[model samples]
Target chain A: MPETILQTRALSVERGRQSIGLPDLTLHAGGTLALCGPSGSGKTSLLLALAGLVRPRAGEVIIDGQPLWRLPEAGRARLRGRAIGFVFADYRLIDSLSVMDNLQIARASAHLARDLDRATNLLERLGVAPLASIRADRLSQGQMQRVALARALMNRPALLLADEPTAALDEAAGDRLIDLLLDLGRDEGIATVIATHERRLLPRLDDTLFLALPAEAVA
Target chain B: MIRLRFVLQGLLRRWGSTCLTIGVGALSIAGLCLIFWAQSAIPEAVKTRISETDMVVGPKSSGLDLALCCALQMTPAQGLLELERVQARLAMDDVRPFVRMQVPVAMGDSYRGHRIVWTTPDIAPFYGARLTDGRTWRQPLEIVAGSEAARSLKLKPGVRLTSSHGLAADGDAHDAAYTVTGILAPTGGVLDHLLLADLASIARVHDHGGEHDHTETAPHSRVNAVLVRFTSEIAQASLPVLISDSETLSAASPRLELAKLMALARPLIDGATIVSAIFGALAVMILGLSLMQGLNRRARDFMLLRFLGMSRRDLALLSIGESLLITHLALLGGCILAVAGQSVLAGMLASHGLTVSGAVPFREALTLYSAAVVLSVLSALGPTLRMSIARDDEELRA
Candidate 1:
């Protein structure tokens, strides 16, 4: 219904001798995709390649109508910094910094004018506004995850790539996190792909791409 | 460009290691400054004290001992130059032809632990001594106190003090009363610690006891040394040798003796410089290692920064900037400590018989601080290189 914001064509990312292949898929504005697989299923490798962090061995990933692999490393980096946001399993927040500073880090690095108003709005939406002055190290895991999600939106990125973002949370927190991500995606018209082993999150996302384990261990 | 607040927080996060690194660097810088201060201050004080006088002729003794006694007043003259010998040198065809003026100094007497230097009236103007309170001494048993002597002993122009037999505080007291006629301004010279009297007055003060046994005989009287000013440059090269060759007396060029003293002290100065350099190198190494360790410890954070679009080059610069912060702070702290310590040292040395004056050597200070900064930057190479090549994706997992 909306414009296609992300797509992949015969994309295969190599890890050691094995490769992870993604079905030719298209995600439009406000669409959500879940990448589900067991450990060592190359889910992270495919995610990295799509995010321009890993070079694809074959095929291509296209984001916002531009072929990602065709760009040079610095160009790809610039695109990722401006157009893509990453959320890691552990939140990966700088412990020494306050939540407010952590959220503005990427914006500052990209030379984008820091919009404290946007940061405050996102933190309040995430229900972590009161913790903005607290150090990241002092926040609970759920609070840190919320802060990390706020940081991912600091630059108002068009695409968010989350890797096992809910793996460390309890079920109730995990359910809230997934709902919040979907809600944010819909409200902001941002495309999102979540990579997770959590089977419970499967029904919530708009689409699912299951990465099968290599044949050697399927038995 | 790195964010100053972020960099500061990065360092503060590891404040224990950071403070240790800073402590080592600060002490090293302080050591370097002290060595530089000593290398410059000792010679400067000597040169300043002897700037006016051209030559010092004293009894036959080590040239250093004579220079110390006659020029610096740091040591007493071992033996005396007979008044006849002094007069003979003044009249000699070889020495007299070049001499413009000579002031004979008589010692071996003290007033309240201050050495009484009995010399001709010319000694006052030679040392640039100005009367701070009263007039110059004009007669026997009358004295002019140096500024330090006046202040420490609380003596005014009209205060009467008796001379002791020798320089020691416990030396036998002479019954003859010496009147304080004037107090000299602080000249920042050996003269600051001396009580001044005319040669005739010293003779009269010592004449009271059997000590008169010698001053009573004028031509046979002994003067410790002679302070000489030559009319021409030729006198400096010829007169000292001509007088030193005499069996009864020794002559020393104040400038030449000062040069020799510096030459003798060169090894100690060199040793201090070497020690300070080693300390500086050691500090750099220690600081560099700590920085490297910090980089390793913060690999995860650095990777996160990379993910945030911080380039490899920026990370490297961040590493260097952190080192610069630590180094400059340490250097500033060390320099402040050194100046404070030096001032305290100056006061302490005064009581122990050394006179150091003026400010710390600023040029040397600037040079040392610049070198330390350069060293700090250079020491960052290891950590920066590691940062430049680090794989954020790999390091974050580790």
Candidate 2:
């Protein structure tokens, strides 16, 4: 069995009057794990906690044998750059920059050399190479999503995190994105975790975890 | 790379607001540039004229007033010295006097209602003047017209013109027509508006009879003032005392007078400059607020950048870069506009018979550029700090 790339124990997050908890979750290396839940089901909160972007109220997130929250914010940021990639639900591409500059910035942020060949290869594989020089503002929603995905993979991070990656796509496009993501993760031996409410994608996932609403409210 | 794109995209997306900020910043910077150019140019110009005379000796009144009248032709002297007494003083071993007799101003003259000054040949060399056409007055009744005077009077060299007694149209008639012997080049000084001739010509116009005869029995001296030069360095200190002790004479020093005048004027200039700087500060503050307000709209973009692995430091650098870019571009634009405006500024000064030197100092330009950079940095401070401080885990969660 591969080593665990991400492990969380007794994690709790609070926002305003609400709080969510997930106990004892671990994502092993070189696998695809799907986190499925309804809206406000604490799916994003869990992902943010795992990515070291959010500070949990209790417990800790351990990645590669390092306690993520125990490190300083800057150290966590560096780890995020080096060790993980993120695909946001909204496809948050910088609208002012060209597609190529966006990819280059991601590589640079990860402290990787800006390799045009690598960016081009990723764009071509993601079917966005022809639109590389165009501004992000000019791209359609699906195109921006692909570019976002390309940017996330630019640094070849050990782990990839996706937040509702297909929320804006049609059924056909969503299935294709999931297939591409799963195939890419398998081919690259990269650990992948995705937060979604789409039950349709569960059959494709190697493993699945259900994050239900807090037990008191559901009852 | 992504961080830069995000910053640039954020700027472009809000083009209207950004341009407005840049425009306001540019105007403030332009105003500062104008002040910078004028401050350096005015003093240097005044100093250039002052430098031409080693010393100015006149009546006991303000030294600056005497210098302005005698050397720069800006103001008239309060009193005059007797020519013989002046000549006797100049006879000293170290004293060299350059005597000038201002045409006894009668005030009521106008050729077709344009004011004309009746003055002499020595007025040209006394102020280091040159002729644009023809020659200096060689005979009584011959006139050398100032540039504006010639243009207004429509008188060329050899053309004859008449005058009234004063600047007014109803002043006494001179009867005899004075011939234009020369046209002076533009000096951008008081001389640009006067008519030049021999003192004798002015006396003749007033029909005061011959020079020595008119002076010997006359109730008053005809000359307005005399400018003098000294051969020895020590003469300046000694001469004023000597002249002041005389019953009929008092002396003034141009250098001392101008210095005193400048001392008095310094605070006013500094105050006005401070006011201008405050306006610039306000502009920078407004820009900062604008950036801060816009930051809220750009939060999603910033979060995306952060998610792509941009550190907080990169965000700060991006804010600074935007400010610097706007400021430097505005500074360059303001300087070019100032240069273009100089001629109009010089013309306005010339109309008032004030000479402002054409040369703008490099230091002034440097100060302007420095102020722009400083203001840019100051404007960026609020936004940079806010962005840096707000990059916490709670804020990024959504």
Candidate 3:
């Protein structure tokens, strides 16, 4: 029933002398798309292209009715800062900074007013509020992933791109993380794209995109 | 949107490297300041001390020896010039026309490690010295101590001290004690370290029994040197020739001699300056390399900042700001250390009867300080520009 927030048409990304193309896809706000693939299938590449971090060799990535690739890198960066939040597979938080500082990085880059209280509330919602003052490197992997999710939500972006968010967590923690991501999308009216190899998380999303290892990847 | 605190945090995390780099920068700056002090302040001090005297006439010897003994109270002359000959020449119509004033000085004694100088009362006003305590020396066996000599020897009005035979404390002391009749105000020159007395006092101390003697062996009557100020510019051309050719004494231009001496020292000064500059550049290079290497290791951190939406220009500025902060700290430390070092050097040279001004000349200091900053920033340029132009995720992928 919600309005469409993300759509891609004939998107093809060049990867080392070969091309990986995505099928035309559209998703509404409050919807979740689970992207599953084998190794070397270009799942991270596709997520990166959708997040305006990488350019596509052909076709268009449309987010909120704006052509993401048509904008210059700076323009695309601004759009990414304003509308897209990403959680990398490695949870690339600055090790020298504390958990609160990691979240403040988002607000700083997007020129948003620093609201530590709001970041703390999001951390509390993500169940890692107790680790707020601890440096990021001192946190456990599961704790780091949760902080990454909290940081991703810091800007309150409309579209969240999570690449292997629960790859290092146990089954129960992974399920809890998936439930939290889906519930946040439904409650905040966000469009979420999660690229993961875990098949268990596929059925819980609103829709799924399956990718196979490319012929060149095998060669 | 790059907060400077992020750069600060990164530096603090690598505090060891940061402090070592800053220390190197500070040492280089301190060395440069010393060179600047030498190249500018010392010569200026010499000029300030000798600017008034036009010519120095002494026993025929090296011009340097004449200038040093006559003006700076440095080095002893070979023998005294005949006072009668100088007097007879001054009485001549030809020489009297060019000579505005002539103050003859006699030396050969010391009091508490300070040179005891003998000259007439006319020499006081010639050097712009005034009595800050008591009256000037008007009687034999009475002395006026300069401000520094009075303080260092702990002499005041009415205090008495025995004079040594030669210009050193190791010499045998004379039987008679010279009364400190006055104390001269600080002139910020070699005079501040001299004990001034009338020529009669030195005559009494050396003669032990003679009175008003103008004999050649009498140290007081035989002038060691004469400080002459010309009334007209023509005196410079006319007088030295008239004195050196007609008389058996040397008439050396004090200013010319000082300039020649400084010129002779130019190579040494320039060499030291070059070495200090090289150290400064090396320090800057090490600082730049350390910061750049640190940045390499923290490439992912910058990538994350870019991912969070900070622009590359802001990143570059942040890096530059960090370097500027270190350089500013080095500048401050260098200035303070330079002052301390200059004071110590001035103190050591005071014992040699040389004046070194405490203040570093502003122009040279500014040049060195500015160069330090420029070199530091230039060294950081390559790394900052590299960081700025790098594509997002390039560092992360590497």
Candidate 4:
């Protein structure tokens, strides 16, 4: 009723020669979901499929009421750029550029105008306003993780795909990032799907999809 | 929609390798340009200098030296030949019909390392030299600077520079302050660099103060060389031997001696061509390897970009654009180096009896630029492809 932001019906992600079938699931606006799995359990792959980055082998993926992979390549790319955001565990920021430029690149990738006020507000919220002029490579790991989170939210996407976004941070820092992510998702009506193994953060999310490791992936 | 700044930022992220590749590329491009320029220009300058003159008649001397000294104005004359006596000898029964025009040149003094040719004003039209500035020299102390000579020596119509005693720059400075009365337009030949003066100028410089010897016509003065035009090919074949039979006069065909000179330099030219090809290949390899060496880091960056919702095409463009920026930077540096290097090369060659035209080879440069770009694209193809295809879940991270 709140309008599904991310939905999958019998979706199976194509992982090279193998395909892993997924259960039917739906997440409404402002909701968060956890994808719990061991290493190589296709969590990252499922996130990729849901974000329209990779083709699903079967069934359907719907983001914001539009069928993913049914649109033309450019249209799909446009949708992904405008409607999706991604975060990395390693905080992938171009090391040479300043923190502000990293956010500008995110806005540029979506063909969006440089909203300086919005970027400044986000950096201030992340407590990184003083670090905006610093190069990404010079930042501490916690600072880098915050700056990366700011870049992810730069485009104000409808859905967020994060691959262990807080894996590299300390427990307290990770807790702070998870709190900021869930609070921002609720305030902005953004649906978030996180691929992570940390159990402490699962209770804060609205739903969880536990992907059991296939036999071939265990050993 | 990904900005070029982002593309360039990624390049500067690895500035050390970027600068190295560009440095090598610039040097290679400059070397290639110089080789091509010298290969084409030297023979061209020689051919144009000897285009009209059939034979060089000077005092008994080496044909190579005579051609280089008399026609190209490369060196000072070894000895002087009597002009009146040579004309008298040409007026013989069988030789008079074969002879055409005769222009005498007396060379000895120099100004700022530039040769001073003391001949009549008739020598101006003979070498196709036209005045671009003030009039031809009317008095012994007045002189006309060639186009290059004026530019290099900074001579204008009113500028006064002293001439030296010999062709070398170290010669005794003359007390006579020579006035630059005119400047010659560029002929792209030897005349573009020579200082043309009248016979009286040499007579004054040599202190041969007979006043009659100051005239522009047959002044009964000895000249360093006589440029001869023959009416028929038969004379060209037999006249140099006939003239050389005399004890004091020697004849050398300008075309024949220049051929021998080129044939002698052919091996060096071939060797330069081979070395340039190798250097060019190596430069391209360094460029490719520079890109290849950074692939892992660049691929990770590109993976981040792709994940950040940058489209596949934008990702590919970002990758290719990175290499193109390096290439464009190299081109700018190479062009500056080539321009500076060519002038230095010209000066070095001039020191040893050769002259080069100062003209930009625009078409050849354009060809080289296009070739360089094509090579750059080819060299970057694999890396760009790898960047676009990089993935966190598949190839790169996993």
Candidate 5:
């Protein structure tokens, strides 16, 4: 039992009056976990809670042994930047910047000394290095997805959280991306948690957690 | 470095919106520049003529109006001073009188319906005028034309022409033919538009011919206004009283009149500047709104940067940098446009017979630039504060 990099116990989230709860999820270092659920089943909510992007209505989220919410706002933000990488479902690339600049910003934001060579290498590894100088808006969805991945890995974060990372890719491209993500996680010795509705991706995960619909809904 | 990259990327991505903002800013800047340039140029132009004149004497009325007419060549009110009385004042020790008559001469006849001004050679020298063509009026019935008048009438020296009553071609005609003597050089003064001849020429045409009557019994000659110069030793204070108390004359000082005129015009100038400033403030407000909206969209991006390890202070700095860059570029653009516009306007006014001189005022330019920068920064305050204080948790979701 290696220590968990992120642990959320009985976490609950409320939007308006509706509430979503995820119970006792523990993610250890150097592993890949998949969060599977149907539409509106709160998979995204659970992911946000673990990433420290959302405040759980109940219970606590401990990242690398420190209660994330207990820290000062600035302290928590610094921890997130240093330890976490995110691949948003929308691939939120800064469209005004070139692909290379996007990665550069991510690296700098992480408080890491800018390493142009490392950024170039990551872009090359993700097969987006050639598009590095092009504006993000000019790139296609697959290219943008790759650039997003490169940005996430720029700081070699302790944990990587991805939401529907393969949604915009074709089957062949999706598999390739998943393979790259897994390989990158293994190489960096970082934990990765992906939330998605795509069941086809289930076989590729190291472990799977199904977020069941609430009991009242099942009835 | 990463923050810089991100901001740059953001600007590029929304280039259409960015360009629109820049254009709006540029236009306001340009407009401010033009207004300041014109306002400053007018006062300088007025001052040039005022500095040249020792004093202006005219009928009792709005001193400003008289100043505007006599010194600036604006149309004067219909009041005539007796020419002989003015001439007598000039005869006093150390008094040099430069008398001018407003020959309401434009209305009678036009050579081909173009307007002509009937005046004397003193009209040219009184305003320090030069000839662009042949010569100033050397003989009676010989005319020295203004550039516009010359261009409009298509007249050259050596040509002979007739006059119409008043300034219109349809006005009554005077049968006497006058020869074009010399065209006056452009002085950017009121003399540009007047038709210059000897006082005898005007008297001859108007049939007011009479020998010099030195007798105190004679009625004073009919003339418009007179410009007087003191010969170093004669006190100006005594002259006005002496002229006003005399049998039939009133005198107005050019310096005093212009001061009064400027005082009356002060409120109007202040109102215009205030309105301009209000519009500028509104523009800044609009810029602030746009920036605030953009901050909302970039909230998640800011969080992403935070999550990547950027400090809140760094993010705040990035916002300020972006604004400063835009403001600086806009200010530069505005200054260039204003200077160019001023030169163009000055040239046009000179061509139209009003001499405008001196560069645009540096203080005015500085005022506009400072106003723009301050307002722009103030407008940006809302977004900058919002971003700086934003919670990381709130930003992560979007």
Candidate 6:
């Protein structure tokens, strides 16, 4: 039996004045799920809430069979650092740091000791090993996204939550990101839930969840 | 490694402001340290100098002037005191028993801005000065240089220096040359800046150009002052009786005169302390404001850090760590500057006949160091709080 990496029941979140009620979901290890909705539909809110970055207004979010919000905020943060990885749309890299440095920061955030070999290995696998010494601020958007993915995978987390990870990239870069996510799922058994408006990505994912219709989306 | 790099780069990002803030902090701490040193050490140095002599008997003038001219050699003699007349008063039945030791000083001359204090060899031990090099003046016209005076004027044993007729360097130079016979070690008192010699040197210089007269018997030409030590407490009380009959002499209390002199200097000391305190307060405010604004400028980056699995507490610590780095650097600079400043101030004071050394007020330094660190932490508090409350779950839209 495949181990369920992510499970949610009756999950709801407040984004601005809109309260979003999400569908029940289950994602097994090495599975990929897509979250699609309109601009103000709280897809990003659900991603944050599921990643334990924000608290849900209702229901339980279970990651690896443990209730996420039942523990204290510190515990949730620790779990987020150790067991989960998040990729932001803008890459969220400290501009002054190099690509390898960004990966090392992830290790520190996870309360893990530095492993230069692990960082080097992750960057090499992402095909940005030559750019490891290059500063994040100088990288192209596609390169930054690759580096961000490498940083997210630095701790080898069980779950990866990405919010529009390919939104800023060109079509070819977007397609490449999709391939990376799928390969990571297939080979590394890293479960992924991506919030994106990309229509082509939906068919590639193992499952899809619609957070809100265009008319249902509210500020 | 990246966190450390960022902490350092954050400082470099605003290099101009960072340098300025560090300079201000250093100046403030150094200034406050100096104020503490000046407030306590100057008066202490002066009191230690004047505590040995009970009274200064000089030609009738203001008691303060007589004490200044005689005991401290800080002022010019108004008139000469007859040696015979000064001795006659000590031989009196009433004043005889009260007199313990008297070093009659024949002044009214100087060499290279240092006072030429001509008395017997006993003045060296009287002022707690020991010979660091060579022996005391045995024959007339031989002299000993105080430690600082030797350093400044470069006078050593066997070096002959010409004396001028007055207390300052601009006075008329005399033809008689006095040979430096010895150098006194530092006494941390008034003795470290004087040129001491026997009374016959002054007598020879004044008695019709006695240049070749190395004799100790050049006649009792003059006595400008007599530094008297009382035999007992009752002897100090008999100062009035000793000077009552004498029409040409006045007794000045060294302790009383020194207190008045320091009292006059109190205002300057207090003003310096206040100005330094104001600067210190201003520096703290600038540091606090700068740290807070720097954090705010990087608010998005901090939020990004939070999203990257860093806890809010960790984010706050990063901000505080930056402030602490700046403060610790400033503290090191301030200490170096303060010690250098103390040494310079001591040199300047020594030239004016008060001996101050480059000794740090340890208690004051420890207190100021603690206060500086505490103030830096307080300054960091604003940025810490701001970082702690910053929301990293920034995306509200889908």
State which candidate has the highest DockQ.
6
Residue-by-residue lDDT tens digits, candidate 2, B130-201: 988998877777888878778877879889887765444565566778898889997655566677666566
Ten residues in sequence with the least summed lDDT for candidate 6 chain B: B210-219
Alpha carbon deviation, residue B166, candidate 3 (Å): 4.3
- lDDT tens digits by residue: candidate 3, B104-158: 8888778768888788899888878899999998788899999988998898999
TM-score of 5: 0.65
Q: What is the clash count for each candidate, in the order shown?
A: 0, 13, 0, 0, 29, 0
Off by over 4 Å in 5: A1-85, A95-144, A154-176, A185-219, B1-35, B58-65, B76-82, B89-137, B141-195, B203-222, B231-242, B245-248, B308-310, B321-352, B357-360
Report the lDDT tens digits of candidate 4 across residue range A1-219: 677888888888866677888778888888787887667777778888887777788889888889988986667777887889888888889887889989988888777888888889989998999998898999999899889888988889899888898899889999999988888888888888888878777776755443443523421
lDDT of every model, 2 decimals: 0.80, 0.69, 0.79, 0.79, 0.67, 0.78
| Model 3 per-residue lDDT tens digits across residues A1-219 | 778889999888766567987778897888788777765567777777887766788999999888999987777777777788888778999888889988998888777778888898989999999898899999998888889888888898889998888888898988888888888778888889888888877777755444443534321
- Rank the candidate models, highest lDDT first: 1, 3, 4, 6, 2, 5
In the range B219-303, model 4's lDDT, one tens digit per residue, is: 3288888888888978877888888888888888988888988899889988876786676677678777777766666667766
Per-residue lDDT of model 1, residues B185-258, tens digit only: 99888788898888887556655545344321232267888888888977777778888887878888877888
Task: State the DockQ, from 0 to 1, for candidate 1.
Answer: 0.46
Tens digits of per-residue lDDT for model 6 on A116-206? 8988877887888999899889998888998999888888888999888888998888889878877876677888888888777777775
Please identify model 6 stretches exceeding 4 Å from their true place: A206-219, B75-78, B90-98, B110-114, B128-135, B145-173, B179-186, B207-221, B232-247, B394-398
Q: What is the lDDT of residue A64 in candidate 1?
A: 86
* Tens-digit lDDT string for candidate 5 (A34-78): 877676666666666666656678888888888887877567667
Interface RMSD of each: 2.0, 2.5, 2.1, 2.1, 2.8, 1.7
Q: Which predicted model would earn the best TM-score?
A: 6
Q: What is the lDDT of residue B153 in candidate 5?
A: 73
Q: What is the lDDT of residue B253 in candidate 4?
A: 91
DockQ of each: 0.46, 0.37, 0.46, 0.51, 0.40, 0.62
Which stretches in model 3 have alpha-carbon errors above 4 Å? A1-10, A23-29, A59-67, A70-72, A206-219, B1-5, B12-20, B148-156, B161-175, B185-189, B207-219, B245-248, B329-333, B358-360, B388-394
